[model samples]
Target: MPEAIHTLRVALPPEAVWDFVKDMNKWAPMLTGYQKHTIVTETKSLWTLKGDVGILSRTVELEVNITEWAGPDRVRFTLTGLNEAVSGEGQFEIRAIAVAGSAAAAAAASAPVAAKAELSWWQKLVERFARWFLGRQGGGQAALPAAPRAAVTAGSELAFTLMMEAGGPTAPLVNAMLEPALIPATEDLAQRIVTHLEKQHGLG
Candidate 1:
């Protein structure tokens, strides 16, 4: 499948970054053409996003399923276009930033481990378990993966990716026609996320 991947360095601990991003409600609006999103259930969501297909601008609802919930590290999900019949998958990965010897050793003292993130923390934990069990039941071994959560002594790096495919005979044409919009959206993912997170700290 065709995929778009973008990565950026975030000036916070991996745990802090994961706590913020694990909740879709907090991060969905960060999409380039995002309009709105609703969490229908713990693992399911309905998202309305906008983009232009050539000269015709389109808005569509997407059915999203969280396939993997690796806390403070990675998350993977798949989406289906409810009205248009397109399907795709995406992932968010966080890796610890590397630094010099003393700088790396001192980095752990800078950020709070949990930081009073009580509201959505439990939801993510529940996601980790639910996705695991569900993935196991319905032949989901490939779909649901347990991402390792290791301690990060330095800042973190965030990466986002998305893959889209038209679910019908016209997939090629659809992908070709939608290439312009898809490219920008995919490229914008990382910058938007970084800017959003940085703004929370009053940074540029």
Candidate 2:
């Protein structure tokens, strides 16, 4: 089985995050390689995704069933492959956290004054190279906003946990191929959700 867990800090209340995540329709398309989805009922849906598995690319259909919906806290769901032998489960969790916005702002305000120095030639060259490499890795995606600069506020921590495994005669081989894709897919979905919500709030 391949499992991935990603957590992000959002400068918003847990209730706000829950309001967005409670509706799957809003974030389902944020999944990497998402094609389409159909809602069958409140607790069930079907999804189509096209993605690369090792050197081969294919489309898979999955049946998603919500097992629990704990508002302002968590959403747990199970996945069953409709057109293939695969099954998985995942969840989204959000919790409140204290954000020291003023303290951080104060630190940032003093950073330039305390470190007004020029970088050496090699340092400048390395910095430029690092930026270029990071830009390429980002794929030009919209960057998330910086943390809020308001007074101490109530923030939320969002986590997405996923576990997937393939079945059938070729289970081992398929799992090997699937393992490499899980983390990237999980990260893409989770970060996109945070980006969307953060942009909507835009306190930063």
Candidate 3:
């Protein structure tokens, strides 16, 4: 199985993130290759995505079922491929930022420095794909706010974790192709959610 987990500090409270994430419709389009989604019931939906694997792109249909919905904390879901042999599970977790005087808080503040380490080849490829997909060639026009209007002291943290696996004869090749894109996909969704919240709250 291939899994990707991305966590980032958001300048909003846990409840705020929950308010948005509770409704999949709000963030569904934020996905990297989102085409559309249909809600079948409170806990079931169908998603259509046009994903790029290496140099080839194809449309994928997935059945998403909510496994758990814990307010202001987490939402867990399982994915079943309708038109392909794939399955996975994912979750979104929101929590208060590390306590101010705790070692965790200090480490949280230093996370950016640690993240500045070198990137792997696949990571570099993912970056290029993202830039191209977003239609920005070398820092094009700015769209979002340059900076948040105010600093957030008691903010929250958001984490998204996803795991996927392909089955059958071609599973090996399909999984290999999917490996590079998973991390970026998770990251893009988490960042977009945070950005949208910041903008809505007038922080951006």
Candidate 4:
């Protein structure tokens, strides 16, 4: 089977970007295929996704294992289908944008302070669970965290890659079916997440 990769660049600091991407509990629901996801353990999770193959859409369950967990930078995981005929690996990468001595860089470097929000009920619930289980709460108060001031450099980019193998050999069909919904959803979610970040931080 072939792999399908999608990349999206968000204007945020590398660390901030990493923080958002590494936290599955916070961002997994943003994915187009996601129905629901639950953390099973420190490095394991169960995900329910809607398999929207142009011809049909059905819910599927997957067990995911964290294969790589590096700090403020990257995440890699392999997923096994629990009730579907697909399996694959995915990864997210973040990096700091190098700013040259330009007016834009200077302005960005000195951008006004970003605002923060109080935690929402759901966020509080997640925080409470984390506190009980992991002994600590992640960022966010009543709302989500704000994007870092440092924007991705002019040429810097953030990329996401998803590779899946199916029992059958209809790779092209599968890719075609998933791409339309997947791409738009990914972009939409990314925008929403960023908007939420801005609202939380008083940027917007």
Tell me the alpha-carbon RMSD of every candidate.
13.1, 11.4, 10.6, 15.3
Native-vs-model 3 lDDT? 0.73
lDDT of 3 by residue, 65-160 (tens): 999989899999999999978899999988775223332332333222111113566876775566466536524211112232333255666788
Better candidate number, 1 or 2, judged by lDDT: 2
Q: Per-residue lDDT for 1-204 in model 1, tens only?
A: 445565566556688789888988887877877999999888899999987666787898899999999988999999999988788998888987532223323232222222111225587587567757876784442221212343333556677777777767888878766656665676576667666765675434
Q: lDDT values of the candidates? A: 0.67, 0.74, 0.73, 0.58
Worst 10 residues of 2 by lDDT: 108-117
Ordered list by lDDT, greatest first = 2, 3, 1, 4
Off by over 4 Å in 2: 102-150
Best by TM-score: 2
Clashes of each: 0, 0, 0, 8
Extract clashing residue pairs from model 1: none
lDDT of 4: 0.58
Displacement of residue 162 (Cα, Å) in model 3 is: 1.3
lDDT for 175 in candidate 3 is 89
lDDT of 2 by residue, 1-204 (tens): 777776676667899999999998899889998999999999999999986678888899999999999999999999999887889999998987555455343223211111001345577677567656765775421122324546656767778888888999998999888877877787778778877886677543
TM-score ranking of the models:
2, 3, 1, 4
RMSD of 3: 10.6
- For model 4, which pairs clash? 115-201, 118-141, 118-142, 118-143, 119-141, 119-142, 119-143, 120-142
Across 134-203, the per-residue lDDT of candidate 4 in tens digits comes to: 4324321112122346443432234565666655677667766655545444444555555444445444
Q: What is the TM-score of each candidate against the true structure?
A: 0.70, 0.75, 0.74, 0.62
Alpha-carbon error at 54 in model 4, in Å?
2.1
Error of 1 at 80 (Å): 0.7
